[model samples]
Target: MLKRKIEIRLRPDGEIEAEVKGFKGKKCTDYIAFLEELLEAETIDSNYRAEYYEQEVLLKDENKVLESIEVIPESILKASNKK
Candidate 1:
């Protein structure tokens, strides 16, 4: 799993600052978009390293599994792509 963390700092002057860590690739932009919309804040600047463009993904195939009941793995059930 990609580890993600966000920190918020509220200054005495009512300005807010957010720090996002541990996100890779366009994931960082996705994270920032959600946070900015949630807080209605404008991003003044961003700092990113080469690692920021790398993404972490996990894939699993569920056709093979031992089950006692009609159980489905959470990952398969909650897959973002479904028709």
Candidate 2:
């Protein structure tokens, strides 16, 4: 079983930061798209964790595998968008 988590932090300077965990590959990005759009934020830099490189096997006999995945935390994206 795979678990998805999102952690959000508010800074003293009125900045928001978000961290995503347990999301494999592009799913993390897809999950946060709505938040980014809602906050009118743009992504500046992205760091993919080791988990992102992990490949998921859907079926053993079928040999079906998912593609490489990467995700950007919300807080990092918001910080970069600030100028």
Candidate 3:
């Protein structure tokens, strides 16, 4: 499983900085958009780490696989049907 993490720090000078970890390529940008918008922050600079180039990394073990799945609660589905 791939883990995603966001690190936020407030500097003594009242400047806020955030670092997105465990996300590769442009995907990392998605995690920070909401915070940036809420703070009305203008990006002064962006540095892409080495991991960004490897958007997805597969393990060496042939049996290992990653898949995307979505689950919706039955109650929510029933309620939506009644609308």
User: Per model, how many backbone clashes are there?
Assistant: 1, 3, 0
In model 2, which residue pairs have backbone atoms overlapping below 3 Å?
17-75, 18-75, 25-69
RMSD of each: 13.0, 10.0, 11.8
Candidate 3 RMSD computed on C-alpha atoms after optimal superposition onto the true structure: 11.8
Cand. 1 Cα-lDDT: 0.66
* Cα lDDT listed for each candidate: 0.66, 0.66, 0.66
lDDT of 3 by residue, 1-83 (tens): 45878787778996788877877656777766766887777666667665555545446787453542333446867999999
Query: What is residue 9's positional error in candidate 2, in angstroms?
Result: 0.9
Candidate order by lDDT, decreasing, is 3, 1, 2
Q: Single out the weakest 10-residue window by summed lDDT for candidate 3.
A: 63-72
Per-residue C-alpha lDDT of model 1 across residues 4-58, encoded as one tens digit per residue = 7898898999788887787655667777788889888877777765546554443
Model 3 ranges with Cα > 4 A deviation: 57-83
lDDT-superior candidate, 2 or 3: 3
